[model samples]
Target: MIDLITAGLDWPVVVALLLTSCAASFITAAFGIGGGGVMLAVLASLLPPLAIIPVHGVVQLGSNAGRSVLFLRYMRWELFWPFAIGSVIGVAVGGMTVVQLDPGWLQIAVGAFILWTVFGKTPGIFKRSGPVAGAFSSFLTMFIGGTGPFVAAYVKAQDLERHSHVATQAVLMTLQHGLKSLMFGFLGFAFSEWAGFIAALIVAGFVGTWLGKHMLARINEKRFKLALNAILTVLSLRLIWSGVRLVFGI
Candidate 1:
């Protein structure tokens, strides 16, 4: 019944979340970096504060995993193990210090850096620092719950081709979200009650990702890069504003 699938939330809310999952996946699959933030914004409005990051992590794990599987062939194998190792270490550190530091200034710094990478001269360091990027973004995502843009900014700096860019980002995010989910489980979040709703969200995301792959194939690289940069610019600005608000206690 709708109640079971909604996990005691209203059916309309569940329906809205399902739709968001699909739409957010479509955007990320087609464009490469906006969907997780979109999904997080929507979930923040609908879910309780305590449930947001953990639930978002599970849903993102599913979304990115689907994209990773679909674009497996295009993944940059060289970066995987280093990023994975860094992510493991980062998550371990985040688990221990999740609540110690304030993330406000950190968000501002990340957003500004992303803007610089997109517009100004990108540091050569980014192209060689897969583990560092993975570790920093993974540690930050534990607090902000929306580090796809942070990771994407790094991926973009690599100057990868469109397919490789998307594929590699998907795989990296799958690892990050997977680790975050396990950490949340270790922290005692009850995922059982949300399983049915999360399943519905994942199924919707998969469907959207499948459809979006076709769109991605149609976009020329030049236009894809343009659109991606535009999206990143907007997202970075939003992040900056949020950090400003947090820091100023506005």
Candidate 2:
């Protein structure tokens, strides 16, 4: 069994993983969510349970780094500092504690949280923002690989234009994922073993981001946001279902 599993982790599998990363990155670049969560789901199914979080974190680091570079000019510096600081602290705690907890519950909680954020009716949900909100949301993101919806809500509350919204998210995600990768490394996740795979995914992510940028320019922002909401909704359901199955063994 062990040999079969290890053998399955060959070059062809690596290529498939990279392609998956590329597809996820493209969706994220275009719609601002789904990528990390989707990648996490796929990786969780393929890898040893122990390897899932760190491996997913590393790939996300590459993807978000590419995005941050592509959208560097639109980053809102004021919004960056608080979120970055909180994210660093939160990710450290999360990385240390995650393996000890019931991940199924965590997934359910995160999925429920996303659903609430997307469907809830609360005044000033997107109208109020500052260091406090940024820090809070960034802290939440540490437990979940992708917090694009939360970031988007905050940006929309601030009424940033399309470019600023996407760019700010790209920068924040870059910081979060970078710190996550570092934490995973500290935990002894072997990046060397997966270097080639990571490199391929990074290249694919760059290409996807480039393509997405063009698509972003041509689409109507409202329509894009609507589509994003739908994608997130479906992802949330999948997460919830996966968590339930894990907990129930059904």
Candidate 3:
């Protein structure tokens, strides 16, 4: 069973991926953001180049979907339809181009995006138009694997309290990743071969999310906001450093 679960990799790597899933879910659940970036960085080393994004998409879709369901009562349903429509449009448009970017450039872009999410205000359009925000962010998520910070920034701008913020944002990501994974499958990413591993990871993420939600209930708004910014800053800086090193051939 242990050997089977390892998927031909070392035991440690498999264990790390599981643990990363848990930790990532916890981070995202507690603060309503940051987990996807951590898991994406970790998964890049564990999986082959091609499977990385699609598998990440599946795992994230499950994780976010679970969070959305867990807090479904608080979901602002009015927000869903516009975001969903925009995500579909964005994915269709992005799927047409289908160009692979150099890793360093992508990393730099993601790093810059994270920094913007960390320090930036939600644009006026994002504040006003859910569909526009959805379209743009979903398109961006394709190029850069983690758009949690960006989505969180937009949701925060809606001035939702913590529970609604988390619930609404989870649903938003669930839609984005669902659109993304289907697009990847259409492009022949081979989700089936990795199904078992993906399921295990998603289950782990779900547990972490459950635990994190409990913590979330205890956190006050001010502390939660402070922690969210702090985590985003650290994660963004890490991405920037990684991009710089790769670009410099270090």
Candidate 4:
């Protein structure tokens, strides 16, 4: 079983990643966001640099796909269609121009932007700018591996109900990560070697989502917003710290 699940990685590391996948999915499913960023950080720490983004994208694609399917009824199609269109364009451009530019500064900027958006009033342009948000976030995801906070901030600005917020964000992430995985495949990442490991993560994430769904049903809108903001704040701080570490070798 261990050999089937991993290639060169230690068994302990594989176990850790499986657990992280489950916990991260629970966080996102219950709160509407935060899991992808958390999972990305964990992957970056544990996985090879070349494997991190691609593997994270595949795991997230499965996690988000499950949530989107479970809450399909609440998705905001108007936002989805535009975001989908822009995502295709963004992924295309990103794949063509994908470079190993330092993501440290970008991470810092994204973290700061997320903090401001969560605490202050969002700009009028972002209130209904699905295509713009989708394009920009998708482009970044190709480099960063987790643009969920940015996309979640966009969805949050719409002032959706709890269910709608979670539902819409799930579908948006599903699309974004799906495109990213395909891009990585085209660029020649050997996903087949990681298939068993990835499948284990997806199954763990699904269990987490199922548990989170039950918890989400019991939370009220006001409390959900409070929790969501808190989670975003912590994630933003983590991003900033990670970026700083990368930039200065701290």
Every model's TM-score: 0.97, 0.84, 0.90, 0.96
TM-score quality measure for candidate 2: 0.84
Candidate 4 residue pairs in backbone clash: none
Taking the tens digit of each residue's C-alpha lDDT, what string does model 1 give over 212-250? 899999999999999999999999998898899999998
lDDT of 4 by residue, 1-250 (tens): 6766875789899889889999999999999998888788889899989999999999999999999988899988888988998899889888889366688988999899999999888988888788898898998898877889989999999999999999999999999999999989998999998998899999999998988888899999999999999988988888788889899999
Q: Which lDDT values do the candidates have, in the order given?
A: 0.92, 0.70, 0.84, 0.90
List clash counts for every candidate, in order: 0, 1, 0, 0
Query: Which residues of candidate 1, in runs, are more than 4 Å off?
Result: none
Cα lDDT over the full model 1:
0.92
lDDT of 2 at 175: 76
Q: Candidate 3 residues 1-250, lDDT tens each? A: 6544665667788889999999999988989888998899899887988778888999999999999988999999898898899889988877776576565766677667657755786567767788887887787777667777767777877888889989999999999999999888888887877887888899999999999999999999999888877877787677678778888998
Off by over 4 Å in 2: 1-8, 122-159
Give each prediction's root-mean-square deviation over alpha carbons: 1.1, 4.0, 2.2, 1.3
For model 4, state the Cα shift of residue 103 in Å. Answer: 0.7
Error of 2 at 26 (Å): 1.1
Top TM-score prediction, candidate number: 1
**Top-down lDDT ranking:** 1, 4, 3, 2
Question: Residue 163: error of model 3 in Å?
Answer: 0.7
lDDT, model 3 = 0.84
**Residues 1-250, model 2: lDDT tens digits:** 4333233486566667777888888877787777777788778777777767666777777888888888888878888887666676676666666455675776687677667767875236334444444555545555555555656655555556667777887787777767777877887777776666566667887888878877778778788778767976887777688779878997
